[model samples]
Target: MPNAAPEIRTFLCRSDNIGVLIRDPGTGACAAIDVPEAAPVLATLEAEGWRLTDILVTHRHADHIEGIPEVVERTGARVTAPEKARAAVPGAARYIGEGDRVTVGGLEATVWETPGHCADHITYHFGEARIVFSGDTLFTLGCGRVMEAEPATLWRSLVRFLDLPGETAVYSGHDYVLSNARFALAAEPENAALQARAAEAERLAQEGRFLIPSTIGTEKATNPFLRAGEPALARAVDLPEGTDPAQVFTALRAWKNRF
Candidate 1:
């Protein structure tokens, strides 16, 4: 039997990104994932009637951490982000790097410096919950562009993230489920789970719902990027079978950037 009250709860914010708000209902304290803007975060805090105790920023992107200053000013919550992001982020009270851990009430989140989407990107792992705030680093069926790092470097980064426990819930930043699915389908139509997930994503999009915070096991079952080393991915992208996973991985992301 599972403990119903302690399950980490998350929901959509503005229908674009899945900003998770985890609070100990037992204590009424809260923590927010990446805050794209201050208003919606504040609204969520208001609705829960919980005090904003902390903010976790995964990267320094404007869309990810743009609302930091305003929120910090109002709530005075402690802020934690990657060490490299300290220069870019405003109002961060504590800087974190790989292996460091932070706690919000009873829940704990470990920091992993996963830099590829940007030179300073990081992922926050809610250890006990088996959840990670992946930012733009890892998506449901896609990963972020290798803008700040080379394809090889980005490939290594993605591979490292994939090594996490399979059941870990991945809460990414953007809502790319449907578009990623279309591209994944084009890249690997034979993937039955991807096809089914595409249908589900299409339905969710049409219903004005969000499709994010998917599990790593599910991504392994459907996400082409997560399956970069598979022969099916090789065929989908026209790469020679048994090519270096890094190369195949590079090509897959490049194709999606265009798609």
Candidate 2:
């Protein structure tokens, strides 16, 4: 029999950073995706009555790791961090690289080195569960800013996601759906899917709900970053037809940077 999907909880921390908790019901083993803040994580764990067994560090950003010491001290949860960020994330009990598998009880995740927002960034893919914890690498309607690598490097990481099943649920690090929706519309104004998605994003925001766990299919149709290969997006960026998708992606990222 297939393993049951793990229970997931999503909440906000530190204004915009997302806090995620995933638990295996059979073993009662829980893991926090990243520690943006200790208080909310602790409170959520207590309220849910889930014992945390691991802290999965996505990157070495200050906001992501600042609450680590406190959370680990309190829960004794083992830390799994990216190998490239060993120095910045001293609390890591295990430094993992691409293809490393991490288990929270019976639930398992495969690590993928997806560095673009920062060199140490990694994404956790729970294959059986069809879930991805895409840290600063990918967002709902946007991808992370090209910080430490070239635009093509980030494009490579983003394209890696395209191979996943469309039903795969993507949990990104931050909630920038509204702003990204606006930019997506600007980048592809004639896209009906993007237009509807932007409208839905506004409604979700008004309801104090987050547009998270966006499916790979939704992003493929609506996210401008993912649609760089499309002729409409290429035209929007003032690029001629048949331009390299990477170049179109570069132009889109530059425009988004200024948007």
What number of clashing residue pairs does each candidate have, in the order they appear?
0, 0
Query: Model 2 over residues 19-89: C-alpha lDDT tens digits?
Result: 99999887888999999999999999999988999999999999898888999999999999999999998
Those runs of model 2 whose alpha carbons end farther than 4 Å from true positions after fitting are none
Candidate 1 lDDT tens digits, 143-208: 888889887777776777677788888888888787888899999988888888899988988897
lDDT of each: 0.81, 0.93
Positional deviation of 134 in candidate 1, in angstroms?
0.3
**What is the Å distance of residue 253 in model 1 from its true position?**
1.2
Compare the candidates by lDDT and give the number of the best one: 2
* RMSD value for candidate 2: 0.7
